[model samples]
Target: MSWTRKDLLAMRELEAGEIVLLVDTAASLQEIATRDIKKVPALRGKTVVNLFYESSTRTRTSFEIAGKWLSADVINFSASGSSTSKGESFVDTAKNIAAMSPDVVVVRHSSAGAAALLARELPCSIVNAGDGAHEHPTQALLDLLTIREKKGHFEGLHVAIVGDIAHSRVARSNIHGMRKLGMTVTVAGPPTLIPPFVQELGAKVSYRLEDAIGDVDVIMMLRLQQERMTAGLIPSVREYSRYWGLTLDKLARHARPDVLIMHPGPVNRGVELSPEVADGPYSVILDQVSRGVAVRMGVLLLLAGRKGGDGG
Candidate 1:
């Protein structure tokens, strides 16, 4: 299939074939990391800019590494201490960066459609790092890559995603991607944290963590999104943990022994997951981080073609 889209706005808009292509492309590029030189010239001379409005560690750093490894010129921009601090409008700030003629602009903002807004206005490819609680496309892609690598296939797999669903861009993206690939997704969380009409995305909702985990091939634990929380979503952190948190005892009793445990990171330790479980044998949190670089590399190379194999 041809890759025509100049922007990756959301997983919800991607076809199943498109998602598979991305995963395969990234897999082919994974070998570069093993080379002694650890560099590829596929995207040399192509300019990639990170335009982030919100704070980030993993997403920002991963994209930066991806661009650099592929030999692209990478620039980073954030809202703090920038013109946005002086009351610059979001569009105006983006427009100023657009004037530099980058090949791709990777953006993360607090607004749901922020990446889409930039895609429409900018004359370059846009990769959605994240936008509000809407979606995180690359993160979802990397998760799929890991699962596929581990399980050998996605068909007939059950993935249970647990935690703050109402404001989880990760959960939303995962639901869309997994369902498209024929995996059953059950989103388990407290009622208030589960978004209304989430079933429209083709997920089974359950308020019980045990019920969700009992039949899953993979257990994806989501972080408690405190920053995006509204009032009264949960009675308290302690109470939420007591009910929804993934503990060793819970997993042993409810989930499959080989069930993969995953978290997007900056985990709240004892809150969403126990430290034992997070660093235990089932966890793939670190692999997810490593794969982000390759996934972003694939996205960049696809959108903005290589100068040449040697980056000439």
Candidate 2:
């Protein structure tokens, strides 16, 4: 089968067949990550550029590690110390990077559609690490892999994604992926934190998280972006937790001992979810981070294709 290059901006871009291929490939790559010699030859000689217009350590470092594991040459760009600090536009910076002829560009920027904008102007495939509150597709993919490894299939499962729904790109992407995989998704948070029209996205919406917690198959919590907190979108962490936090009491109300827990990392601990819940048997949070490396490798190799063999 010919490997078609996939630009992973959102779960909407993934078809069933493609999801299967990517997941299967990622599972195989996971085995490689377990080996003493962690590197793989699949993307030897490729050039992978990590272009970030925002600050991050986990996502950026994960992408860089993924690229290096596949034997790709990697360049990590930061906005603060780079030419972007000199007032260069994103397009200009992308064009300049493209001049070096990278096999793929993994971009994360503060603007919602920055990666898509870069995709339109660049020759290489684009992997949207994140783009504002718009989407974080790979996070969704890795989450899917984590759930699949545990629950086997998403169909017939009830998933409750609690916390900041309005501003979480992870939640947005997970909603799409879960629905596509035939899971029932319910988003729960304060009225202000959830988009009023969230049901239009095929998810059941609830103002009180308790309403959606019962007998659910998965509990997905999102990080509370401090920027959102400072914006006063959420009144205060104490108030936010009272209304939306996944406390021990909340988990008990769900009553499903097997209800798998998940979170995209840099967890706020006592804020979004309790420390006990995060470290509980139900939590696959750490696995999500580990799987991130493999999922990114799968995406990078797929996008790079045979062109990666040239080390461009």
Candidate 3:
């Protein structure tokens, strides 16, 4: 199928083939990073704007590098020092940026539907970096690319996503993408952390970490958001670690020998993951970071480059 979407808002809205096309495209672009020049003209003459209402390190930098590597002009926008601090509304800020005629706007906001709102209002393609607890489509796509590279396939593979599910857009996007590609997912966390109706989203729920990881091919640990403590969701970091934190002992005793460990970063050391397990041989956290740039490049090429060129 030809690339037709103007925006990538969520994995739930993508067909399985569309998801596969993105993964394959990312795979093809992985070689660019290996080259010394590390630049391509795929998106030359195109402009990408990163409009972030939230603080970020990984997603923001990854998109910037992706656009630059593809030879597109990239602009970085932050809400803290911008007109947003002077009470400019999101729509107003976005419209002001859109008036400059960017080819793509990659946005991250605390509001859930912010990306969708930009998609409706802006003439440029909108990529959802992170939208409240709604979705992080590129993160999920990179994760899918990483999984396919490591495991050689997606169908019938089982992934256990553990920790802070209710507050994790990464978990939500991964569940939707994985299920569509015939991968089974199990979400494990405290009952309060797990949201209602996740079963309807095609994920099995497990309260215990051991139970969830035992037979799965991949164990994805999510960040334990600090706000969860203030929100009274989990009792304490110490207590949560005792039950949910992944350690070498836990992996040795319960999880499969070939199981892959993954985290979406800014990892809370000794919180959701032990030092040994996080740096262990099974961990592919770093691979996910590298794949992120490739995934963003693929998305930009498809969405922005297609407008004027073959995007190859």
Against the true structure, candidate 1 reaches a TM-score of: 0.95
lDDT of 1 by residue, 83-147 (tens): 45579888898898999999899999988999999999998889999998999999999999999
lDDT of each: 0.89, 0.84, 0.94
Q: Write the per-residue lDDT of candidate 3 for residues 104-146, one digit (tens) a residue.
A: 9999998898899999999999999999999999999999999
Overlapping backbone residue pairs in candidate 2 total 1
State the RMSD for candidate 2: 2.2
Q: State the lDDT at 282 in candidate 1.
A: 91
lDDT of 2 by residue, 1-312 (tens): 445654777777677667767777788889877889998777777889999888889999999999999999899988854445678877898999999988889999877988889888998889999988889989998998999999998688889998889988898888888888888999988777898778988999877777777868888988887777687787788888777778777788654888888999899988888898899878899999999999999888778874434442
Measured by TM-score, how close is model 3 to the native structure? 0.97
What is the TM-score ranking, best to worst? 3, 1, 2
What's the number of clashes in each of the models? 0, 1, 0
User: How much lDDT does candidate 3 score?
Assistant: 0.94
TM-score of each: 0.95, 0.94, 0.97
Lowest lDDT 10-mer window, candidate 3? Answer: 303-312
Question: Model 2, residue 253: displacement in angstroms?
Answer: 2.9
Error of 1 at 95 (Å): 1.1
